[model samples]
Target: MTGSLISPRVDYASDPARSRGRFQIEPESRTRTPFQRDRDRIIHASAFRRLKMKTQVFVAHEGDHFRTRLTHSLEVAQIARSVARTLGLDEDLAEALALAHDLGHPPFGHAGEDQLDECMEAFGGFDHNAQTLRVVTRLEQRYPTFDGLNLTFETLEGLIKHNGPVLKNGKRMQDLPQAFLDFEHLEQLDLDTYAGPEAQVAALSDDIAYNNHDIDDGLSAGLFTIEDIKDVPLVGRIFHQVQKDYPLLDRQRVISEAVRRLIGVWIEDLTAETSRRAKRLNPKSVEDVRNLNEPLVAFSEKLDAEQKELRRFLMERMYRHYKVNRKRSQAKRILKELFGLFLSEPDTLPPPWNETAQQMTKDARARVVCDYIAGMTDNYAIDEHRRLFNLDAMI
Candidate 1:
């Protein structure tokens, strides 16, 4: 794969020069394409900066070596760029989607998200994907001219619909998040269709990165041993090959080598599979890719089955392990306490948040509080809970 040359640019690859333009028009950059500017803006946003301390799988304070949201985003960008480059897609757009993917993930990984969803049930449910749309469209608050990063239509479309169209079978989505509804009122994302091919590549790149990295984290945390995972499908085969090739290799090296190979194999398979699909679909333009019913980017059936098996292994062995469950329980408590306190006693919230909460209606007030908590880092959430609830710590 390293020696393979980039294919000639395809008509279906997103063209930055021909971008649909930002919501708020400005002078074109002398040095950057529209997508490049979008990527740069996201990299500099406060939400992007906060991802450094946000939990990926393990809480940030759990260990120095664990993958935080920031590191995970970077890894996803690398994989996305490689896939984009190999397929003659726009590398910058793929990288942008990869980097911006998790900007809306709350403090303690899925645990925080789950708690937030329950707390907001009265107002509107919370979803990280919808929150990501909110972050870019309205939450970032950097520019004097715009409330959020005024990105191109392509970027916005990709970010919101990266998981395919929001609608199911030509019906309007039931219970769409308030943020998504708000954005659609402003500028419709055509949520009935799949995102362009670049977005599809970025989404698959996320799956590739998380699956492999979670294994590394789980092993390091002693949740499961390397030997315990040797019976899993695709991963198990990679491990066996690595061990047989390097009989005396240390455990750490064995895991690393096997994971590296696993990522490579997946990338190779994805590139081949996507190309095959493109040939059959004969998409005339980027729009044609979106209009198609099937996803342009996908894994082969065999690999997809194997990947599902790996997910099951991780779910039972790592996600449901007692240690992780305990952490998740504590995380839920902190978020619930914070949400309840902030809503009941809006004055307790800090200066601007207090003022902001005071000015909103009930549902809006809850949404504001939700945003504040969702933006917190794992340690910040713990510290904030301590400040609010622990007398000794407050003292």
Candidate 2:
């Protein structure tokens, strides 16, 4: 265990003398650690389950193959794990982080989020990542005094980084080198911020998954054609990589093939570079990841470029297409009506939610309205829309 500090499972962040708020259900005596408990808590949470009903591109229930929030998260977890395990890092923590990554995304996908963001602009304003951090840290309550998953600083750090540097308390996080210093215990952490390497990989993995899957979903929904998608150069590169890395995977298997190939390339690049770097370090200790010379930087830059290009391709060809845009607009109407009905109108709201809304503050009521829409499954959101807002709602 002497040289084991270099291992990924090892908590690189200096230990916190105290991390308050324990897990609601501690894992039984086993190989699972606290982070695993954090992961499992997320896996089993009611919030996590709601992902099945949320949209990823084309809405759920429209077809079996269109991506759902759950599937997208699973893809991210799979990618993160492959990267973590290849380097002997902590796979469980990465898996957990991926699952919890999108817990704060509202119903109707980004459109619903856009409406909320605009409406709540006077408030903190909504960003999925910020909301995700809020969920695990405070809002996903199934308890009284303590809400959220109550995960460790390590896990929370992963969520924050995966979400990318945030704007919190009127500050953009990436600008501040002392991000971690804002936490409860400042001294224990070495880095001013502590987003594990796996967290960074997950952020990029999210981009990789959605870029391919969104194209597939759009085509399946008849919004675009594979030929239309192939016209984009980045799309061509993706499929090219897909065929080269995964000959057996068909064109339709874009997400899986792209993710698998990306992770493999990164791991191979990372392993070779780390090994080379190890040879150059002094006997006293290895060079920290920060000290890496140009090779690592070059690889990272290349990956970033590809990811951006791929995302842009998806945005142009599919995400912003007329067919998808029409549906997104309708879905926003559905959620907006629900927001006004359940939180603003008050009378037509469901009994339970109506009661909850009544007890909330004005701003809290609006957020509660957002949370209600966020928690709804795809089918259920439609059902609620009919029950509360539609003329045919009444029997």
Candidate 3:
């Protein structure tokens, strides 16, 4: 490949030089490809920095050892770059997508997202993917000419469509998120087809990273024991093997070894399956990869089934554990109260946001409030809730 450190670039890999270009044209970087520049921009974004304070399955205040969105994104980027390089795809684009994927996530993880969606339901429900697009295309305001980061079309397309085609058949299954609809007028993304191979790699990398980390977090939180997960599919087998090989190892070391081995197995399966798919499909270019009926990157069927079982275990023992649910409930309340307050009393918002909300319609005002709440870090949200709700607290 053109930028590959190990292997030659595949014919179907996305080429930064052939990128569709940014919405706002600018001088190209002399030191980096367009995709590399995109990665740099994402790394420098304010939203990306806030990810450090955004928790995944656990609240940030709960424990320092738990995985935050920032760590998760970094882990995903590492896995993505590894997969992209192994498959002769553009590692920079995969890394960029992985880094930017969670930039739109609100404080408190899924609980906050769910509350925000309910708060914004009448004004066009919130979708994290759409919120992510908005963050890059219109929310960030560091640039002199544009409000958001002027990312490449390839990065934007992957951000919007990484999970799959946005459209079902020839039409949207439902209305596009308002943010997505707003951006579509500026540039038409081919939403009916799959994203290019780098994006596909980044998407799967996210799955691999989160699954393994959640197991680690769940165990650390004491929501479940090693014995509890000893019967799960792929994960259980790995844990058993680790125990057999090092019978006297400590619990933490066993967990760490098992997670490490599981991640390696997932990466191997994904790369091999993707290579097999590419050989059978014989795509000539990135466009050919996108136009195919299915994704070019995937785990094997056996692995996929096993992965689902692992997810089910996490869902029951970890995600739905009483401790996690307690934090989630508190998170939802904070977001809900904040949204209600901001929407009803726009003048209470900070200076610029207050000024902006004054001129918008009610629906528009709701969106503005949504944007404000969505940008808060977990600790900030909690502190803001206390400041606003407790009369005894200093303003």
Pitting candidate 2 against candidate 3, the one with the higher lDDT is 3
Give the per-residue lDDT of model 3 (tens digit) for 1-395: 46634668999999998998988889999999999999999999999999999998888988899999999999999999999999999999999999999998999999999999999889999988999999998899998887889999899999999688898666664567776887853337888889999999999999999999999989988999999998999888899999999999999999999999999999999999999999999999999999999998999999999999999999999889998899999999999999999998999889899999988899999999999999999999999999999998748
Query: lDDT score of model 1?
Result: 0.91
TM-score of the candidate numbered 1? 0.98
Q: Tell me the tens digit of each residue's lDDT in model 2 across 298-345.
A: 134455566577677778877898877988998888876776666667
lDDT over C-alpha atoms for residue 157 of model 1: 90
TM-score of each: 0.98, 0.76, 0.97
For all candidates in order, the CA lDDT equals 0.91, 0.62, 0.92
lDDT of 2 at 308: 72
* Better model by TM-score: candidate 2 vs candidate 3: 3
**Candidate numbers, best lDDT first, in rank order:** 3, 1, 2
